[model samples]
Target: MKLAIMQPYFFPYIGYFQLIHAVDRFIVYDNIKYTKKGWINRNRMLRDGKDVIFTLPLKAAPDSLDICERSLSADFDRNKLLNQLHGAYRRAPFFSDAFPVLEQAIRFPNDNLFSFVFNSITGICDYLDIKTEFTISSEMAIDHNLKGQAKVLALCEKASADVYVNAIGGIELYPRDAFAARDIELKFVKSKPVEYVQFGAEFVPWLSIADVIMFNSANEIQENMLGEYELV
Candidate 1:
């Protein structure tokens, strides 16, 4: 089996999904420490012809807390967030078809941070017709203290993966020889440049998957998912 693992992200860019789709199993690394500056609770979206950041408010926790232990702030207004997304993309070509998926994900009654983000990832995968199996790191039996490449290797071993795929950014992080010693092939996926019409503006790249969905049909998006990456 081919496997890939990544921290859960809220409506991440297309490259994130490309990694998931490129693998036979995708693992959501939820047991790791939560980073405030990370894309865990926030992501970029296109607004006014430019990229804008949006975030979900979380209840206060120690800096060392795992993502699975974090919770959404009780005062966070989900509807208001949905309204912001609506105002930003309501006029896009496929907004009507995409907004409901966004709404269903954001309104998913769970307040636990990891659960919410996991749901959103799976929800979007379903919309895009991605059928890759998913595994949660916290629920797995691997040693939780392993870090970096060791942790990744453990997960791959646990999943019986002969080929491990990661996003291109991980090229510097994972040593090629280490995976080779273990009889597992390591490869990185780089997304091919993707461009589509954005109403009344020059194309903005690397916005959230939600932005791509708003402007493109499911078939078009799926084609992008299938053809948008090259493994190296």
Candidate 2:
């Protein structure tokens, strides 16, 4: 079986989905230390031909905690933020068809960011009709170390994955010889730019998937155009 592991992100970009789509089982690594400026809580959107970013405010987050254990800000104003998203993309040509779904997704009742993120991802999976099984890396019983390549290899052994798939960002973190020692094939996914016409302007590459979902229906977005990655 194929497997990929990554941190849980809030309404992340297309590269996130591409990684999930390319693997049979995808693991969300919630046990690692959470970085303050990572995609864990924010993503970019388009507004008036410019980029606008939306983020989930956190409350009393510790510098040592991983994203999985981080909490949302107590002062979070869900309705107000929802309105900002609507105001930003409501003018896009396909907004009429896509806003309701995104609005519903952002307004989901849960306050915990992790639960909120997982639900949002599941909702997107439903919208696209993707059937890949999602799992948590912390829940597995792996035998390798949690630092660097040992962590990945350990997770792979726990998942019983023959081919371990990961994002291109790990080009330096992973050791090919280590995976080969474990008899597991390693494949990296290089997600290409997904372009769409927004408001009849010049096409830009790599807008967040949330932006796409805000401008197009799930059915329209479900059509995977550039497709998956192939390693050399």
Candidate 3:
């Protein structure tokens, strides 16, 4: 089966979805170290023609260690953030239909970044009608190496995966000969730009579906997804 592994990200970029569309099973590496400044708890969105970042705040503690094990800040007030998002996207064309879904997801009572991100993943899958099974590496019998080829090979063994597909970003980090030695074929995925009409006369690229949904109808959004990305 085709397997792809990635860290759980909060409303990740389009490349993240491309990986999901390419694989049979997706393994989220939530058991790994938590990155303090990555997309684990934030993502970019378009706001009034400018790029804005939305984040889920985490409470810091003296002993905060693992990213996978870390929880959202205890002081996080869900309703307040929901209000902010609503105000930010209220005028979006698809807001009426998309807001409730996003609001309900953001209201989930969880403290971990993984829980938040996983909820977003499920929401997006539901929105886009994707049906791929997702697994957590920590819950699986995966190997424990975290460096370079060994890490990739270990994850493959854990999933019993024959063909391993990953984001194109890992091309330099992994050596092809190493995966070949272990009888596993490796391939990379790249996301092509999808264009859609927003509120203006011009088409925009790389804006999140949230941006499109707020400014366009679901039918138009679905129609815009006609473009396809590639598995390199």
Candidate 4:
């Protein structure tokens, strides 16, 4: 089986989904520590033809907490977030179709950071018709104490995966020789250039999947963006 694992992220860029599409069992890491600098609770979105970062408000807590342990701030205003998205993409052609999906995801009634993000991701995947199976790392039988590439290898072994797919950026983190020693193939997904009309404005690349969904239909995304990458 092909496998890939990554920390949960908010509606991330198209490359994130490309990683999901490349694997059979995609594991989402929730037992991992929450990093303030990471893209766990934040992602970029298109605003006025420029990329802007939107963050999910998390309650003030020690940075060492696991992602599942983090709580959404009490003051998280779902409407405000929805309004921000609506205002930004109101004029886009696919907004009518995409808004419902985005609204359902944002309005998911969860206060835990990981749960909220997971709901959004799965919902978006359903909308895009990507049927890859998902697994939560915390619930797996593997040793949870392992770190870095060791943790990944443990998960791979536990899942009996013959090939492990990862984002291109992970090439440095996971050496091919290491996986080869274990009789597993390691491949990196390099996303090709993804360009689509953004209401005639200068195209801003790598915005959130929210931006992509707003402008492109599920069919367009599935046909072009879903397979628009190379495994190297």
**Candidate that scores best on TM-score:** 4
Which stretches in model 2 have alpha-carbon errors above 4 Å?
143-145, 226-228
- For residues 1-232, write the lDDT of model 2, one tens digit per residue: 9999888877778777877888899888767787877887888877778887788899886698766677788888888877887788767766776666566778888776677787777777767777889997778887424686788888888888999988898878787778988989888888766677677788655666768776566666667532545542
RMSD of each: 0.8, 2.0, 2.4, 0.7
* Candidate 2 Cα RMSD (Å): 2.0
* Ranking of candidates on TM-score, top first: 4, 1, 2, 3
Q: How many clashes would you count in candidate 4? A: 0
18-133: candidate 4 lDDT, tens digit per residue: 99999999999999999987899999888887888888999999988999999999999999999999999999999999999989988898899999999999999999999999
Ranking, lDDT, top scorer first: 4, 1, 2, 3
What does the lDDT come to for candidate 4?
0.94
lDDT at position 39, candidate 2: 81
How far off is residue 22 in model 2, in Å? 0.3
Candidate 3 residue runs with Cα over 4 Å from true position: 62-64, 145-148, 201-209, 212-227
**lDDT of the candidates, in the order given:** 0.93, 0.76, 0.74, 0.94
Error of 3 at 146 (Å): 4.1
- Judging by lDDT, tell me the better candidate of 1 and 4: 4
What shift in Å separates residue 169 of candidate 3 from its native position after superposition?
0.9
Model 3 — TM-score against the truth? 0.88
